[model samples]
Target chain A: MVRNYLYILTGVLFLYACGSCGNKGASGTNGLNDIPDDVVNLGIAEISEEAMQGFVDNMSSPVEMAALIKSLNVGYSNKYLAPTDKIEDYTTNFQQAFSLGVYGLDLGYLNMYNKTNTVLDYISAIKTLADAINVGQFFDFTTLKRLAQNNQNLDSLMYISVHSFNQMDNYLRKTNRSNLSVLIVTGLWLEGNYLATQVYKEAPHPALKERIGEQKIIIEKLMIFLQNFKSDKQFQNLISELSSLQEEYKNVSITIELGEPEAVEKDGMLTFIQHDKSIVNISDETVQRITQKTEDIRNKLIRK
Target chain B: MRPYIKTIFIFALFLALARPAFSQDISELTAQCAASAGDVTYLKDFPAKLDAGTPGGKPPSAKYSMLLSKNTAYRFTICTAPDSEGEAILDLYDMNILIGSTYNKATGKDYPSFDFKCQKTAVYHIFVSFKEGKAGNAVGIMSFVEKL
Candidate 1:
């Protein structure tokens, strides 16, 4: 049976790759770049004074910036979002904006670290700066979905997630804890898989999902690190957020079970799509506690 | 140049219709592939030569210098790297001849069957790339065929 299946698959591939199958017409391209700057503003995140001085001192050359972006895995790939123009925008301007955002913070943080020599102090100050900027509310899930659907500025979404991971990596490095730094790096790898899966699940495609799943083991390992290391502040923040999100997920699970929206009231709101429309439902009290935990992390960032 | 453009456009029209219909058996085959994030879209030129027999993930390093012969039917496929698993737009040319093209979202390691016929034998080039980044990813290609 397996041999027969393989033959059938090969035959199908042969027929599909050859001229026997007709063309599937091209999808419409995302129109030209008219995205406004305000849609992607780098908010008021305070960096350490030493970090800022360091950034100014080490003014990155274009070559260096390009290399950094490439190393961070922040380039456009033609295999996912297309017509080529969209990819170009992502690989170009979006990358620039992200570099600007992270560097702006990195410079300040470096300065503070050099001046104070206390990593915890730097983290607190940085959190205070992040809090002032209201960064968390910048791109909600809905905004992200819209960008992915329109194929506009999706790279920004990617940049933010990866950039955040990089920020944590930098923090871990400053603390001189090589072990936690590895965990942070692992999280970065896993986050890519998570983003790909989230994108594929919204729009069902076997090939795309399969492509996303190719990196699943890495992502699962990242999740394991997040679960295991609770002392790391950044990991703690991510875990808290993921836990709250899990509550939202549980509401959906309950809906799937009981056939109707449950009236459970929680502090955090979970929204999922059903039949092409977004359905919002409240979470249970357990979910609320998770939300509180997330809020606490957010508060610490703001206070610091 | 304008007239040459018109001639190329008109020839493209003819190639589009004649190859798929009542065309004679041909020795050459045509194919097209789109760009992948992994496919090096930033490349300004094609590899010197490509041998289909090499293996997967190993593209030809040499640029193609030969064109297709007249009366040859070709097969084309489009795909993207998993990171770029989505829509891919393809346009084909044979030494400035607008041969044919197609698109596909069925992401895999291979392209879809959107084949065409070649009416001339010369050193032809195929250009494949995408405009989007981190999402609409694809790669496509065309290959020759023979009867033995």
Candidate 2:
């Protein structure tokens, strides 16, 4: 998706870098110093700091999610993942950024299942997307590829990949490219939700069921961010797509009932935990409805 | 042109020589703060820069937002370069609601770390900065203990 944005950037550079030579209204070349700043092509939006922070707290780590699913012993299915061949189809910034995230979660899923053979395809695609987005400096593709090639020590691979992503996320925020950050996180959340709902449909488990319902809250935050950039036609479409999932989740309520709290000191550290339990009251019909919406949105996202 | 080249060459040399020192200072202090946080598994640490020279609403602050799962306990270890002066403070906030802080400035003491027991699996925010709104560098480390 990001490759498409290159054309827009080239157009922008051509308009601005002409240095007034092409700004004579088709009559004659203007002087170097007379270039207008408002010459009709400086359109782009950034993710606000507040919305970026929301994404930071909002996304559950894909690796962690995949790890959970692995622990549950669910069989892996590539059918649920965005195919590697579709990598080149995503040409726009929106498609690239969002699918970068989708593929990221898919990588985690593959890693969790120790599917080493399929991992390189994802790393290459992710690297291409990262380079397109200009955050490729932080993604150590060589190191990561080496780890994947080794494939014996999974923890090291997980740690390195997570670190690479964390650095990218931080660098993006530091440089105020929160739009890309948000898209990446959005992809992660969407794919993670899709995986859970898919797995839950196959095997009904309480934990996974709760996980699906709890996304109602996450989807609500995601909707708010998507709304922030609704000026973009694609974001508007995304908002529309997620709004359906939100509708299914509207009735899913999570209430916290406080339990006994205790404080214990271990190794000179004061550790305290509130024994509070959260009850997610979601209907089975609601879960099915949410599953459908999640699949729809996720499929729409990865369909290209 | 010859003088200009000599000046540029000197400045370049200085930058090359000083770059290591600068990295050493921040990285060493960060490692110190991180090591002091105790036996929990080390997660990723974020760099923080607090400065008085920054413009409005600017302070060297790092905000970490992540899920602190319910029935799970987490410990946040924050180390600042100016901790000797009790300047670095880390605060835990839940969805815009201020929960707690590292140094209860009222007590004039800085705890190297703080623990949080999540009652609900919700997003939690960790805000790191220097006390008194001063300028400095710092790091915050998060880890889970006894996932019961």
TM-score of 2: 0.76
TM-score of each: 0.21, 0.76
- TM-score for candidate 1, please give it: 0.21
Q: Output candidate 1 Cα RMSD.
A: 26.1
Against the native complex, each candidate's DockQ, computed on alpha carbons, is 0.02, 0.29
Stretches of model 2 off by over 4 angstroms after superposition? A1-55, A71-79, A259-261, B1-44, B52-61, B71-75, B79-89, B95-115, B131-134, B144-148
Q: Per-residue lDDT tens digits of candidate 1, residues B71-107?
A: 3344445454334433444445544644444432333
Q: What tens digits encode model 2's per-residue C-alpha lDDT throughout B2-64?
A: 555555455555554454455456656655655566654334565676565354554556677
Which candidate comes out best when scored by DockQ?
A: 2
RMSD of 2: 9.9
Collision pairs in model 2: A1-A90, A1-A91, A1-A92, A4-A91, B49-B60, B50-B60, B50-B135, B87-B131
Candidate 1 segments whose C-alpha is farther than 4 A from its true place: A1-225, A228-280, A283-291, A301-303, B1-148
Expressed as tens digits, the lDDT of each residue in A24-133 for candidate 1 is 11111111123332321211122232432121111111112222223334433322211111212322222223222332333222221222222223233223322222
